[model samples]
Target chain A: MAFEDKLSMILTIGILTSSALMLIGIAAILIQGGAAGHSIKSLIAANTTVNTRTLTLQDAFSGLSGITAIYLGIMVLASLPVLTVAALLTRYIGRKDNLFIAISATVLFDMLVAIFLIPYLLH
Target chain B: MLLLLLVAAGVLAGFIGAITGLGGGVVVVPFLALYLGVPIAYATGTSLISTIATSTGSARSYIKERIANMHIGVSLEIGTTLGAITGSLIAAEVYALHLQYIIYILFGLVLFGSSYFSIRKLKMKNFVPGKADWSTKLFRLNGSFIDEATKKKINYHGRRWLLGLAIMFIAGMLSGLLGIGSGVLKVLAMDSAMTLPIKVTTTTSDFMIGVTAATSSGIYWERGFLQPLLIAPVVLGVLVGARLGSKYLVKLNSRVVRYLFIVVLIVLGSQMLLRGLGVF
Candidate 1:
């Protein structure tokens, strides 16, 4: 299969999924982003005034506290495109290169580094 | 309440950002620092990681389109990858310590500049053939992408290998230093300088940023900045959001989106600068 043809079929599924749920997903994300933005703003204000309280160790981890909830919510949205486009492209290209495979490897490399470093940085 | 809100911000940023190629940074970063209580450095690093995820996710579409031009993307990346290593080192040694404000200002400026370039492209003529620069002509940098709108082949003569390589170098530096994906610069190089249509430029630029970020993420990991738990979900969000956004982009009014993108960049840039300088 030519790359273009393969892509068309895969995108059909993607377009369907996106059309079905884009708005709902968008709304959910908006609310989440607004909250994170607001919390940090208040913290900055509180910290600056009177120089009363410096940021604590827990302060750093606060950003990721919401990661799981936000991640899961967004993952459904993310999966749609990857499945649609990637599948489509695979069909179109006929020959698959190791490009994405390399990317997956690099991502793993990134994860491993993070795994080691986050602990050291926090301490 | 605040934590709940931050979670919401992450999700929303993911939602709108993928469409805009922002990956929730413009919205999430400011909100994290000003509203959610996250520190600026933490916010910046997190935003950078998410931006890479968004780009990686979106690469699927570009690959599908074949506009990503993997040959060009991978080749020019040599420069971008090198630039990333250098910039990260500089940021850690010099900017991270004594001249923090300088770093903020520089990154903010890069943002505004790239935004302006994007906006300028919106006003530029649609795919009029321009004479390729001598450099582009030499390397056969000129190629065309299918303009789905006009349903016509848009051909151009422009600087290819060197121009992209140079632009990627600058883009990589900013990516490492300030935490932006620098797709804006990469896109501008192709759109304005190389004369590719916006879709090709945008998609290819997104295609390229992943590798650039990968380089930095490695160092950031070894030096201990990456947090798997923190990055995992965000990457998940970014991938999904960017993929959807890229797919739907074919339907949206890109001119309108371009302006919106510029405005967001300006807003984010100013916010970061002010906060970093303690003027916020």
Candidate 2:
């Protein structure tokens, strides 16, 4: 079978895999009986009041890790198609470096998804 | 309000990561935990995904340039891919055994090793690369690249054999578990053990990174660690940043890049330690 055909198959696999995981996590929350909803506690480790929390003087980051993980997972399967295309581009088109550029393009696209796609999803 | 901030952070981290050859995961993992109120475990998952994505950006370019040795890369990839499956399984075992301290120690060592090489290799850039030995003769680990500054082509040789594969296996295992590019390990495997030159080692390391990412990506996906909510911004940011950085490589200084690379690793490594300790 062609790489493209396999790629689409893998993508389906990725979607099914990720969605199942999310559902499982969400189900864990449901089973926890409102004890573990996707609330601030589910997302963040600490509980700081909005007004009185001490702000650090330096450029300390207000990290976005939970959301970041969600997006990172999303990007992988998303990039698989790009991975397939990159492979094809190198194989039939470039004929020079072959799988290398394909992998690079696939990775680059994964990063881009993180930068551009996450905000809308949160809302 | 927080959503806007995350978008901005994603963009900033991606730009810095692309220019430096640092994994976008290295940038995003901490940023997500500290700024966006993400948990350490989730951040790690996101970071791993971004690392896979960002590495591929360079993988494409390197391959396009024929800078990557595909045969060696793919051959080594088999080891990495299988190692990844085993390592991912081991991640669960390690976590269950509560031997997370071991992982922290390992991360620290890797950081120190990368720093030493980055520091030490600065002055040795001009040496003549030695000839291809038994490995290059047997496995034929050889390549050529156009020197950007000189506009002249530089050829490299990887003349060792048995040792390089061993290094590749070790590198792959570490890479799968840690979510790193393992570029340093790949370089060590190629340059020192296999007798590859510095240039070829870097390019080959670059080439090898994507396979490492792919290896773990499969498991991360299998375990349901990947989520769309996190993957989008980091991947987009990395793609743009990598492109910008690649375009600017000719004008950049290698030493500065190397230094920046070490600094980021140190910061990220510490963050991982802190998170693992449950202090942050």
Candidate 3:
């Protein structure tokens, strides 16, 4: 199969899995009355500020044990693109396409800085 | 009830975005921030997540249909990713300074600008193939895809690659800054600068947005903006709605989509501007 076909398959599966996880999270929240004791009312409240500052990664991961579905879903959604880029870079390397490899590397570096370096610098 | 409302909103956004070939972040941002009273920062972050879902949702068919140009998309990412990093830095500064109103004003301006271009684009006919420039040869910016509607294989090459990259850089910055896919600007860069077909422009823009969003979303996450609860319903709804929307896209007349886009842009643009100016 062509590269595009592989990519499409990966994207389709990634999206389906993430969406399913998100839906399950919603169901759990609704039925359980909220994630980890926070009521659904407060979680979705119009005036709420439930951001990363308030909800740590540790908290989110802990909630992954059937307490909250959304956090894991989001983790999957966010990481899929990074993984796709990595795959593209690997393909370019196999073909020895320096130009594309460089471009892909640049994109990965940018992502890394945005995800890790910048946040660390800000502190 | 709130989850249901979010899902409903996401579905509408995804439907309109996919059908119009505009992408959903534009609609999601304004709807969440303006209509639903979410903070602008949180709204943008949430919309960024939705963009990834919509892109992934429609990507399968786009790839199968072969309307998208991966070479062009990957090459353009060089500019976009760098721009996204810059844009996110700016966003961090703006939020820290509590000058998010400036971003609102910029978003409004961009929306109005894109609407103008969308109308202008409507008057234009199909692409008249142009000569490939030096950059095109260097970058290998050429490909052919079958036009599903015409049932003919359309062969084409791209020119003005550097120009396209420059425009894509700005588009990337806007994507990161606003937490949108910024497909309008990406399409504009390709459609106007690269002289690609509108179909190619839209599909290729769709192809590129996911990586761009991911790059910035990482920053949004680090900045403590990725609110999981808010994102769940929006992501799921948009993925499903966009899938349904893509099925109907080929059947709709271009003129109808253009008109709908103009109307939406006008209303959302003005609302964002008014809210930014403290008039709302």
What is the per-residue lDDT of model 3 for residues B1-280, given as tens digits with 9 covering 90 to 100?
A: 6778788878977777676656688888888899888889988988888988777676567767787777788889888888888888799889999998998999899999999998887887666667888978888877886665676777888899989999989998999899988888888888888888766777777778888888887678878767777788888789878888878766655566668878888888898988999887
Sorted into a CAPRI-style docking class, model 2 comes out as incorrect
Q: For model 2, report DockQ.
A: 0.06
> Which ten contiguous residues of candidate 2 chain B have the minimum total lDDT?
B222-231
What DockQ class does candidate 3 belong to? medium
- How well does candidate 2 match the true structure in TM-score terms? 0.66
Each candidate structure's TM-score, on Cα atoms with residue i matched to residue i, is 0.66, 0.66, 0.94
lDDT of 2 by residue, B1-280 (tens): 4434544655655555555555555567567766677543445556666665555555555555565565566545545554555565565456557676555556656767766766676666663566667656555567677766567787776655666777777776776666665666776676667655554555556556655665565455444444433444455555566556545544455556666777876876776566557665
Question: Where is model 1 chain A poorest over a 10-residue stretch in terms of lDDT?
Answer: A44-53
Off by over 4 Å in 2: A1-123, B1-20, B34-37, B97-105, B195-199, B274-280
For model 1 chain B, give the 10-residue run with minimal summed lDDT.
B224-233
Q: Which sections of candidate 3 miss by over 4 Å?
A: A63-68, B252-256
Task: Rank the candidate models, highest lDDT first.
Answer: 3, 1, 2
